[model samples]
Target: MDVVMRIEQTLDGALSEAEGAGAPPGLAAAMRHAVFPGGARIRPRLCLAVARACGAEDFSAAAATAASIELLHCASLVHDDLPCFDDAPVRRGKPSVHRAFGEPLAVLAGDALIVLAFETLARHAAACPERLATLLLCVGRSVGMPFGIVAGQAWESEPRVDLARYHRAKTGALFAAATVGGAAAAGVESAPWRCLGEKIGEAFQVADDIRDVAGDPDELGKPVGRDAALGRMSAARELGIDGALDRLDLLIGEAAESIPRCPGAAELRALIRLEAQRFLPKELVRVAA
Candidate 1:
């Protein structure tokens, strides 16, 4: 199977297990609705890429870690699209979870997905106790209060906030987790590799910020101007369009440069390059033409 198919299959299995015997009616379907209609699966793919670079002895563990991260990401999205947050009516080109399944179900589905992420990770750890513990610790730190996506969302409510810190916590945290979790799965715990993950995470956030401003809703499958509309701090708000693009370029370069120190750095580098192109300003492309 192709990498995407393999990852999707893994995710599907985990989701199924999460909805076991007594799962509330419609809940499983709602959760599946929020998750599977196909996304780029970039975060999990990145995790696998990093693991391959590290020469992971057990690809299954690495793949499990990747799926776990994606589950957590989906959970975050369900919550983010709720009326209390972005209030977005659509997601991935469909009605938001709350819109499709009612607010209560949507809330439960998000909560379930979060629990599912940990469960998936724990299942992977059964084979490698030490590595599993390390992965849990890293994933916990990246998703927990004061430093994870939760913290990132909390930033929106705070009266005073730092834009970079917000971006790092909200979006960069998962990217960091993906890299670190992959490394842990591979049993490779080196300082340089960890730093590579950090850089890539930050770059991913920067690119996301750029896309918020430059990307079309049809393409992104979610509301675009919500960041500005909600008065939330964003790279575009602080740096402006041109400046955000420049920052994205710098971040991508840094991410790519860090790859040389990683075992499977070349593939990671190529992936980063391809993703970077996605964020390039259309004007820049037109200028080159």
Candidate 2:
């Protein structure tokens, strides 16, 4: 199967497992709703890409990690779109989870999906315990306190916050998890690879900042201009569009350079380079230049 199909099948199977057994009646459906019609599946694809670059013998473990990362991502979105946060009316071109399922159910659905992420990883741990543990830690750190998505959300309420810190937690954390977790799953333990993850993560956030300012709602599948409208700090706001784009290019180059000295590194570098185009309109690219 193709990359998209392979990712969809893997995620679908995991969602099915999450739906089965003793889950509350509507909970499974709600969780499924949050995940399907997945956006780009970039994080999971990154996970798989890193795994491949690391010479993984079996893709199953990395696939599981990818699915788990996607689940956590879905859960984060469900929460982020709630009235408490972005209060977004639509996601992936559909009604937000809270709008479709009601607030309480939406909250439960997000919670359930998070649990499912950990469970999915646990099920695959037997084959690669150390890697599994590393992935779990990386994901948990990226989703939980201090420097995770949760911290990202918390930053919105703080009286003072750093733009870099907020972007790293809110956006870069997961990208970091995706790359590092993928490497761990492939049994590759190298500091340079880990640095590559961080660089890519930062670049991903810069790209997102650009998208929030210049991307169309139809293209982004969510509200644009919300960041500036809310007075949220962003790279575009701090550095101007051209400056932010330059920063993104620099970070992407850093990410590409950090790839290990190995046979497949060139392909991995190419993938990292493509990430610079995310949510960037062709016209905007010209205007920003």
Candidate 3:
């Protein structure tokens, strides 16, 4: 099967665990809202890509690892859009979880996805039991305290923020986990692949910063000017559009170069180049033309 089909099928299988009887109907619906019809499925796609590059023999474990990474990402987005957070009204061009289901359900949905992500991983760990511990540890480090996205979000609440640390934790952490989890699932050394993920993650954030200032919201499937509105640190706000674009270009190049040598190295580089299009945003594309 194609990678997209594989990722979607695994994700569907993961969510099915929540759809059965005895689960809260509202919460299960909310979780489905948070995940279904995803945006690019990029993180999970990255996970599977790295697994392919590393010659994964354990398809079930790799697919589960990828799906778990994406579930974690979906959970973060649901929480990030909460009224207490971004208060984003729409996501993927539809009412956000909080807006559609109410704050209580939104919170529960996000929390549920987090638990479900780990559960999905654990269930599939038996497929590649030898790599199970590392897979769990790698994914765990991308979500929890001190060194994960949770810590990344915590930075936003601090009295002072280091932009570099903030960006790495909030965004790069999960991307690193995607790459690392992919490697571990494939029974490969995962550490060296981290730099590629970090660079790509930072590049993605920079791209978002630029689009927040320059792109169309309907096209973006969310609001624009949010960074400036919230007084958040933004590449476009701090560096100007031209500078942010330059920075994004630099990071994308670095991400491509950072790929560790492997049989699928060339294809991964090509994938990075293709994914970079998502970063460029349509508004900028018109400008460049």
Candidate 4:
């Protein structure tokens, strides 16, 4: 199957599983609402990309890993748009889960999706049981305490914040999971892939910060200027837009340098360059203009 098709199939199946066995109909619907019409599906795409770069032969396992990463990302977005956080009422160019389904259903939907992510991984363990532990570890560490997306959200409530740590946890953790988990799914040493994910994650955070400051909501398909309004730490706020852009460029360079010596290193680097272009709001705006 094509990459996009595989991902969509896995996601659809996983969501269906959540709706089974007397699951609440409204909650299931809200979960489906949060996941479908996904924006870019970048984390899963990166996961699959890294899996292929690492020469994944277990395509099923790789697909499961990629889909799980995307689920976690979608779950994060559902929670992030709750009334308590960044609550502007739109997501993926549509009413957010909370806005459309009510906050309680939205919460249930997010929780269900988080559980579903792990379930997807466990269900696919038969494809490559040996790597299952590592995959679970990667996913767990990316969403749990101390240094996951949970920690990233927790940072917002702190009296003082470490911006690098904040960004790493908030955005970079899952990217790290994608790269590392992808390699592990392929039965490769995940260590070499870690820095690439870290760099890419950080670069993404910088790009997102830039977009939050300067992007059009219509173009971005979501509200902009959120970081400032929420009084959150932002690369654009601290470094200035030009500096943040420069930093994003630098991070992509470093991410390219971090790619392991694999069969498709050169091609992967080229792909990274192409993905990097997608992150630049200025360039995107200029083209749109």
Model 2 stretches with alpha carbons more than 4 Å out? 285-289
| Best of the candidates, lDDT | 3
Clashing pairs in 2: none
Tens-digit lDDT track of model 4 for 1-289: 6888889999999998988989778998899999998888888888898888888876888899999999999999999999998786889899999999999998888898899999999999997788888899999999889899999999988898987898899999999999999899989889788899999999898889899988888988898888787777788999998898778778888999999999878888988888887876745422210
lDDT of each: 0.80, 0.83, 0.89, 0.88
Over 4 Å off in model 1, which ranges? 279-289
Query: 66-101, model 1: which lDDT tens digit per residue?
Result: 998899999999999899988789989999899999
Mind sharing the TM-score for model 4? 0.96
RMSD of each: 2.3, 2.2, 1.8, 2.3
The weakest ten consecutive residues by lDDT in model 2 span: 280-289
Clashing residue pairs for model 4: none
How well is each residue in 1-289 modelled by candidate 2, as lDDT tens digits?
4667878988888888876789777878888899998998988999888888888888878888888888999999999999988898999989999999899999999998899889888887888776777778878987999899999989989999887788788888888888888888888773456678778778777777788888888877788898888777788888999999888878877778888776578899887776567646666553222
| Worst-scoring 10-residue span by lDDT in model 3 | 280-289
Where does candidate 1 have its weakest 10-residue lDDT segment? Answer: 280-289
- Order the candidates by TM-score, highest first — what do you get? 3, 4, 2, 1
Judge candidate 3 at residue 29 and give its lDDT.
93
Candidate 4 global CA lDDT score: 0.88
User: Model 4: residues >4 Å from true position, as ranges?
Assistant: 282-289
